[model samples]
Target: MTDEVSISRRRLLATSGSVLAAGAFGGCLGGAPSEGGRSGLPSKVEVTMTSRPTPKFEPRLTHVAVGGTVVWTLESGDHDSTAYHPDTYGPNRIPPDAEPWASETMSAVGETFEWTFDTPGVYDYVDTQAVCTAHEQIGNVGRIVVGNPELDPDAQPALRPPQSELPRIARTRLEELNEQTHSLLSDEATTSTEEP
Candidate 1:
């Protein structure tokens, strides 16, 4: 009985020693430091969405750094990204003529789409699906502004209407008139002010 007790005590000590050794090794490998210890590399940023931000079926994204990548992960339903420029290459799997940078229709619940912007430019995109009648009319659209470090010190990204198809003169005049009316109502007048 004494011998058996001795063996059991030895086994318990061995097990406890092994557990302590493992914990020490994990700490050396940077596992949950107590304080002031360096961690590993930075993690990637992820963005999620349920539906298009625009009434026209477009997802809106703001400015990101020149080398940064924007990943649009669809958490729930179907979606796509159709760029305004037809001449430029778009989502790799999609056809060239579809859109400048259009992504294929993503129907799966966890579908993901990513775009990396290297050049400095303002890119506009839209969802081509016609399920919503007023989608495009009500502005189901998004914009991306890629700015260089030197060109844009403040990195002030902005969204503007596409310049390729200029607004009709009549529409422009009407917008101007509306702006003037608003200014008059607000009692703020300035001849150089422009419509947004």
Candidate 2:
């Protein structure tokens, strides 16, 4: 029995040490964004949907590498992440070759929907429930930038027809998202080019 206890204690200590080490170096992990380069892009990101204090998608904008995946986790209230595509009764705001997606209503807390983005481009999405339309009217929309697709920043999908047909607040938010994506990717390009 003493030998058994000793072995169990040794195992516990080893596990604790490993946990502490991992915690100490957690920031060095791959998922955290790095400075000025495509290498900074994450392979996966989580977006949260909340209803209290007004319905909204936390982060509002996400940046991921090509083939990266985004998981929409419903933290509170009913929500679904739906892309802005003709099939969804909206303009094509995602990459021309990208497949459109729409998550079913997730009403339970902690429920989630995920999609892997294969094409490189800017994509716009929203929680498309009628009750949430009011939330959208106030700019509760989301956008994702998958990799860096060459796009005329000024002519981004948000500024085009049908997509441009979104509510003024939603349009404004998307335009801001587009500008941010352009700035971030452009800065990365400039830095990479300037490096030796």
lDDT of 1 at 136: 36
Model 2 agreement with the true structure over 31-93: per-residue lDDT tens digits? 344322355577887888998887888777777788888889999888889888888746778
Residue 97 accuracy (lDDT) in model 2 = 72
Clashes of 2: 0
Summarize candidate 1's per-residue lDDT along 36-60 as a digit string, tens digits. 1122111122345455442322224
Name the top TM-score candidate: 2
Model 2 spans > 4 angstroms off: 1-38, 153-164
Candidate 2 lDDT for residue 13: 100
The CA lDDT of each predicted structure is 0.43, 0.74
Q: Which candidate number has the best lDDT? A: 2
Model 1 lDDT at residue 183: 35
Q: Model 1 TM-score?
A: 0.44
Q: Please estimate how well model 2 matches the true structure, expressed as its whole-model Cα lDDT.
A: 0.74
| TM-score of every candidate relative to the true structure | 0.44, 0.75
